[model samples]
Structures are given as C-alpha cells and as structure tokens.
Target: MTADLQLWPIGNCQVSALLNAAGSIVWSCVPRVDGDPAFCALLDTAEDGNPPRGIWSAELVDQVEVRSRYLRNTPVLSTVLTDARGGSVEMLSFCPRFERSGRMYRPVAYGRIIRPLAGSPRLRMRLAPTKNWGDPDVARTNGTNHARYLCDAHTLRLSTDAPVGHILEERAFRVERAHHFFLGPDEPFVGNIGREVSRMCDLTIDYWRYWVRSLATPFEWQDAVIRAAITLKLCQHEETGAIVAALTTSIPEAPHSERNWDYRYCWIRDAYYTVQALNRLGALDVLEKYLSYLRNIVDEMQEGAIQPLFAVSGESELPEAEAEKLPGYRGMGPVRIGNAAALQTQHDVYGQIILPTIQSFCDQRLFRMSERADFERLESVGELAWKMHDQPDAGLWEFRTRSAVHTYSAVMSWAACDRLAKAAAMVGLADRAKFWSDRAEKVRETIEAEAWHAESGRFGASFGRDDVDASLLQLVDMRFLSPDDPRFIATFEAIEERLRRGEHMLRYDSEDDFGLPETAFNICTFWLIEALFLVGRKEEARTLFEQMLARRTESGLLSEDMDFETGELWGNFPQTYSLVGIINCAGLLSVPWSQMR
Candidate 1:
C-alpha cells in the first residue's frame, strides 16, 4: 500500500474503502464505517521477509504502467495496467447500490470486473483479510467457485467467474476475456455470476448519473463541486442517516505529531456543515436524512446537553482506545480507534441541531414538514442552548485540556434562539416567536460586550482574550454580523494578519493540547478565501482559490490539513469538512449562470 493520501474512495453509503494509486484495496471496514477493519493494510507493516497482509490487489505480470480514473458521475473506478510486452487489462471496481424490490438495495459487498484491453495480459489476484484490527488472517473455507471468509462479526463470501484455483494460490493466469468477482455476505449465488454482476454494474452507473443530473451545480468548477458532493454523500451511513468526518483515522495532522483521532463517527458540527454545503447545491436528500438523525438525537436528549459526536448507529458513548497490532500511517505509532471528545462539553452542538431543523419547518418541497409537536420538541433543545450560551467547554477545535467561554459557542447559542424565532414565525406562533427573539437579543448583547477586543481591534477567539482563530472568520456566514460591518472588517483584518502563512492559513497561531501545529488547516484556508471576497479583495481571493484547487489530489478531493511550505496533504483522507469548503467557495466565487449565458 502507498504511504500518502493519494487515494480514491468508493462506497455504497453502507461501507467505504480507500484504493491506492496501483488499485490495491488498502483501507476498509467491514459491515459499517466504525466496524472492525477487514482490509487494514493501509496501516499495516510487513514483518521481516514477509509480504504485507490485509490487502486485495490484482497485479499484472511484469507491469510497466498504470492509469486510473472514475467513471463519469459515479464512484465506479476504471483502472488499466499495461505490461512490458504491450499487454494490458482493465479493472472496474464498485459496490452495488440501486433500487431493488421497491426499496434501496445496498449490501456489504465489493465488486470487480477484469477484462482484456489489448494483448493477452497475465494477472495475479490476492485477497487477504484480517480480524481483530490486523491480528491474523481470517479463517476460510473454499467452494468450487467461491471462498467463505469467517470473520469475528460476520462471514464474508467471495464468488467469482475466474479460476478459483488460480485465485486461491495467487498464481498468474492469462486474461483472454472478461472475469467477475463479488465479495459479500455469505449466501448462495442465485444465478450466473458474470451476468448478474454486469447487470448490477449497469444499474449502479445509471443510479449515480441520475443523482448527479439533479444537482444544481455552479457554472464554474462544476466537476470539482460534483466530485466533492459525491464524496460527502459517500461519507454518510444511510442506515442511520449519520455522516462521518472522514473515511480513515489516525493519519496524523503532522508527521509524528500524534494529533490523530478517529473520524469515522458522526460529529454534529461536521454534519451541519456538510448539509449546509449540499443544501446550497439543492441536494435535499442528504439534508432530509440528516434531519431525521437530528430529530432522533433531540428526542433522546430532551433538554440534556448533547455530545459533540456519536456513532453511525447513534451510540452516544465512544470511549477512546488504541489498536496495538497495526503500526500507524507511515509508521507514526499509537493508532487510535475511538474518540474521547464525546465526553467533553461542547455547547455549540445545541445550535447546530437547531440551524438545520429550522429548514424543515420553512421548506415547502420536503415530503414531511415540521408540525406543532416537532416545534415543541425543538423548544427543549433551544432552552438548553439558552442555559449554556455563556458556559465553559471545549470550543470547535476540541481542545484537550482547556475550557473557556468560547465566543463561537455563544454566537451559535444565539443562532439557536434566533432561528427558532424565525421558525416560530413561519409556523404562525407569534408569542413563541417573541419569546425566542427576546432571548436571542440578550445573548447577542452579551457577546458584543465581551468578545470584542479593543486593544487588538478585533473579536477574540473566546471572551476576555486577545487570541483570534479561523472560526472567527465565520461571523458573516453565521449571520451574526454583516460582511461590511466595521467590527467584522476589523476582526477579519486581524485574523488575516495573524493566521495567513503565505497563501495558506492556520487555524490559530498559539499552541494548545498539541505543541504548535505544523500544517495549515484546509477548511481554515477556505474560510479565509471567503472572507477575502467579502471584503472586496476579489482578485486576491480568486488567486488563492486557484492555488487550493491545484492542491487537491488527482481524485479532485482534499484532506483535513496541508503543509503550507511544501504543499503536501496531511491528516485524514477525504475529509467532509474540507469537501464542504470546496462546495461553499465554488458557489460564492463561480460566475453566475445569467452572466455566463
């Protein structure tokens, strides 16, 4: 497996896996996003004189060159490998997802189709899976045309049209025609494997293209926005309607800096941003599903403070732990599995829930609209926001050992009250609207009095502090302040002076739980670009945006962090927050359709 973020993601909204440049399956979890990894070779280290385990690769004998790309508008990948003798083979990889039997049929399966492209090409297929987070190869039983891998949680069966003996022995064989492989839940293959997989592939392609055609894309960067949108959609667990932060965990923020944490679970803050960006593109399916998830969380909390995150299954308790067997990405040890942030107090989440729920009450296109009972349930959440608006907790950065009355949290709390009033007005509850508006005004007055730092001529990161962060750049987007407000202009200038490193931007200048951040946070840089455009620096904003677009991997996606000096990507792969940035900036900066016409 390769040791970088130059990877492509393919999923069916149920499970996801990362493929290296050579088309090897390096990182994937079985069953679900947070389940035990069946292909953990991305973080695996080979023993002395031993080949790497936990990988699935189809290698061409005497391979000379390889080219890979995604099928237009779909997650299906097409990879071609050429051998020294001018022989070539193409492989199509995907997970089946389409409507079947009047419902969506997305199983825990991986499909591959290999066909000869030119001359006779020899191929070797190796499929090795591990259990207990890279401990040992799973036990298996073989059939005439398939193999059953017995995992701890479930049994995975692989049925194929290729020679079973050649696959089991990992021996090279000639590819004269097409071959098919389907690895999924242990069950009988009902029909001809070749014909069935081909049909699934065609239907899957149609499904993705239909979805893409429905997106309201910006005139410029339409391809970038679509890929980012697809990537974000793949990050969600459709069963629970919970969207994850990224596909992989423990890919450190900086080399050996130990800033890695598990991101497979759903964070309230991250999901909010994902929906907001997709909503701009008029992708309401994602927003509708996420709203369902928020309602479940609100029903359970019933006025209690919500955690920053939860599992895809909506499991609230995620105690942090480490996997001892696997070494880390590029051998940066201490690979963690769960996140401890769930136990911390993050009052900002109360507002995140309210922000999205308000849409259902106002939108006319949804199948299910918010009703009086829904409004009552939301009131409990708003009451909690009012109570915790000025309380101390970890801020959006999720600082480990620090607690402060963060200005961002307070502003979000105000948003909770502010949006609730608007929703109440829409639902024809004048008394309730006035009640929430009064609370919002009180919270706003307090934030303005305390968060503004006259000495620095800007709003501080937290109340009564001189420090500023990239999140402060969100005042305009959050509707807390107008873009041209004098106070906001002063704060933007201060942040630009403190955080901008060349064309990139850091989250902050000061040290926190980790010593000093060695890489620029990708979303922070995008936030800076938006702020620049708002302040009438249009040309400068466009230039910096072009620089960021150039930095994305060949897959048209970005990670969580970037090295400002070397321009290398660090942190987790296919970060949803970073993808949200791409969509948000493209919408703001792209030429209007009216002008283009």
Candidate 2:
C-alpha cells in the first residue's frame, strides 16, 4: 500500500506541496505547460499500474518530510525532502525559454533531481513509463547513462549526466551526490535546456505577475480569483484557442459510481461566458483568439450547425469508448472519453457561439474594414440560427434518455436572433435585420406566454415540465427581465426555494429523470451571485461569493459538482464553466457599470 500523505500549502500561494506522511517527494507536475509527470502515481493505483522507474523511493527511509512551492509567480515547482538518516533531496522542474514567433511556437521542459548523501542511505532511482494509458506494448532502449521508452506515436527519453545503472525492470539508478535527468520526446533536445529553463521560469513568473497587476480589484477574494484565473489560462491550449473543461477526466461525481465523463474538450455553450469573463478582465487578446477559433470552425465545417463540443484542435469525430483496463479514480468504473454529447442537437450553440463572437468584436473595437468579412460570416451564421430556432434540440444538459423543448434553450435562441438583428443593422443589412428582429419578437412573446409557469411563479425547465431549473437565473443576467419586476422576483425566489440547499445550488433535481443525486453546480452558484447582485441584494451576494470561494481546495481548484452533504468536490476538476463563473462574478463585483460599458 502507498504511504499516507499530507499536502502542505505553500504559504498563501495557490500551489500545494504533496508529501508522504513520512515526508518524501513522490509526484508533481510543474515548470512547463504539458510537462511530463514527475510523480505520476496519482494517475493510477500501484497494483494495476507501473511505478516511476527511478531510484528515488521514500520507502527506503524510516521517516521523511517533504515540502514544495513555486518560485514566485513562475510555473517552476520546487520540492525538498529530508530523510530520517539525515539525507536530503531537492527537485526542480521548469520549462525552457523561447521567444514567441508571431506564427510558429517552440517550448521545452526541464527537470532536475539532486540528492546529498549524509551517511550512505543507499539511494536508487527507477524510471519506468507505460505508454498511452499504460498499454504494455512499450519498447525500451538503453543509452549511455539513461534509457528511452518508445511506442507508437509516443516516445520518452531520459538522459542523465551522472553515473547510472540499469535494473532488470528497465529502471535507472544513481548513487552519487548530485544527479540530473532530461526527459522529452524523440525530438532533438535543442536550445540550452538548462539556461532556457531558468529564463522561461523567470519569464512565466513575470507574465503572471504582470497579468495579475492589471486587475482593478484586490478584493478579499482576489487571491483565489487570481489562482483560478491562472489555472484557467493554463488549461487553454496555446497552440489552438480551445479551452478544455479540465486537465484530467473520469473522476467520479460520487465515489465508486459510474457518473464520470471526459471533459478534455471544448464545449460550444461555454464560449460566450468564457469570452465574457476574459473580456471583463481586459484580456481582449484571449477573447479575440477564441472568437477566431470559433470562426475557423464555422468556416471549416460544411454544415452550419455545431457539435456540442470539439477537440482542442477542432477535430470533430471523437469516438466514445470505455477504458476497462485501468481502475478509475476512486474505483469509479468504465472510464470514458470522446464525449457522446457532441452528437446531440443543442440549439443553444447558435447563441452561445455567435453572441460571444459579436460581443468580442464590439468589446475589442475591431471595426476595421478587414473585420467586415468576419462580420459577414457571422451574419451568415445568423441565417443558420434562424433555421435551427424552430427545431427540437437536446437542450443545454444534453439529456441522454429523453428530449424536450427546453425553455432556456428557446430563450437563448431568441438571444441569438436578437444579436443577429443588431449586427445586421450595424452593417447596413436592413432587410436581414428586420427579418431576424421580427422572428425574435415572436419567440420572446411565445416564451413569456407559454414557457412561464404561472402556478409556480417562475420559468419552467421545459414547456412539458413544471420543474424549475437553475438556468432560468440567466434570464436576469441576460437582461430578459427587469431585476425588480414582480414576475422576475417570483421566478428568482422559486429557483432559490427549489434548486438551492443552503449556499449550494443544484442544476436541477434529476431524481425524477436520471436518478442522479442532487449536487451543487459551481456555475449555478455564481449565477446566484449575479442574481443577488442584480436584484438589490449586494451584501448577500458578496457573502455568498466568499462562501463559494472557500469551497475551493487549498490550490484554488474547483470541480463541476460539489457534494451538498459533505462539501467534498465531486465530478470533474477545474471545470471551465466554474472558472468562467468566477471571472464573471469578479467582474460584476469589481467593475462599475459605467466602466464596463
């Protein structure tokens, strides 16, 4: 069995140093974006997966103490371990430095593990890698002082400048005072990895510091907001403008249950909110790139409609399958990938994608003549929205077992048409403007008359069901109703009564449909923050915001769901929607309406 562990917070910083209870450095991912895992034991259990093939094992000592932290604002992670035998080991991981070429990009990763022997503790380091989710077809080749593991489409080379011996299980060992290992793909190790590592470390630190400096508010919760923002930024695939939902997937919503789903791809519905949050932070550059990415997808696809989600690089066909080989995190079975929701018809995609693109263009003041083609392209997209508005879609949740004419989905469809009408008028497409505007008005009338549940005094989840949904809270943020209107207040109270448990908010009760237990949706909690702020409850809003921020882990990470009963994180970690909520709420709290305009 693995030893007990305790994670120590690095001062007030958002980084956590994970150490065995006995005080040893076992696993960490740091320094560079997409760096190789230094301690990958967290990915799989010991019995079903191979351990790192290295001489560094805390089990060799009677007792150990380990601690770590980042070097200021940089991504570099530094860890130190001290053994009962008076021996100490320090490890550092960082990315190499490179100047960003306006078009092409190059990045490198560096890791160094150093140990000083005090009284012959007999140190040994083992290095072993299971290629492509621990498939056993890995091939290994020995180098002068290191080894290489190669498999189809993947290669890992470990080189050390110290004396090293190979073990029977394709591991490496060193008994000297100091040892270093360089690991990467078969690509040439170019551009002074060591110097680049130091320089890149400094550069990353400066980048984060400078970015955080631009924030207008250092509110009580600014620390958590900054960390969450940084993590969100890290999750963005720099090469492509896609923002993935999380770094890893298949973490169960309820331990030992099969509710785990892959979140490593971008979702269309998350586009507008994500861009809105970034735009509020004065990060127009990120919004611009993401909008360009959305346009690229529309430009490349033969069809006007969009999938629910897509790969970071715009790959459309992601086949869903189960990985029965490895036991899932916390024994959640049937780990899944390639979300099946992508195939579902989510009509909200029209508004979610286009409204944000239009918003970004307006926010960034990108009114150059060159932008006309992009504006025209969006107008073309609006035509597609007009066609989809009347169709029955899977709605926002992508319910698997049934379909309904979801009311929130229709509301967003109306929003798309309304934005398109504005865009058309702005560009002198007066005929198109009138057509979309008339259609939008009709939809709005239909929603207000048919979608509202008079008896319950709020918008229903769908025209078919009277149940209230957390999504209706968007009506206030989207400005579909006056905040102080009696009907709007009634709807807000109904949502709070039906969907909220204390400070935790559920998306909706799924017991009647999916048989899933009620859990807090992080995004919905932020919606409550916005709803409260809008409806003249500013103190209550700020109080709830702080409470939600406290729910984040020591490293300031939040998952998709939080267990209402235990306050434990459930579902996927570092969900994009959750981070986007944080950014949006922060903007509402920090920036005044005049400045926002």
Which candidate leads the pack in lDDT? 1
Q: TM-score for every candidate vs. truth?
A: 0.99, 0.84
Off by over 4 Å in 2: 1-43, 47-63, 85-90, 95-126, 162-181, 191-193, 214-218, 363-370, 512-514, 590-597
CA lDDT scores, all candidates in order: 0.91, 0.63
In model 1, what is the error at residue 184, expressed in angstroms?
0.4
Q: Encode model 2's per-residue lDDT on 468-501: one tens digit a residue.
A: 7788888866667788888888888988887888
The TM-score of predicted model 2 comes to 0.84
Candidate 1's clash total is 0
Which 10-residue span in candidate 2 carries the lowest summed lDDT? 8-17
Task: List, residue by residue over 62-176, the lDDT tens digit for candidate 1.
Answer: 9998888999999999999999999999999999999999988888999999999999899999998888888666899999999988888667899999999899899999999
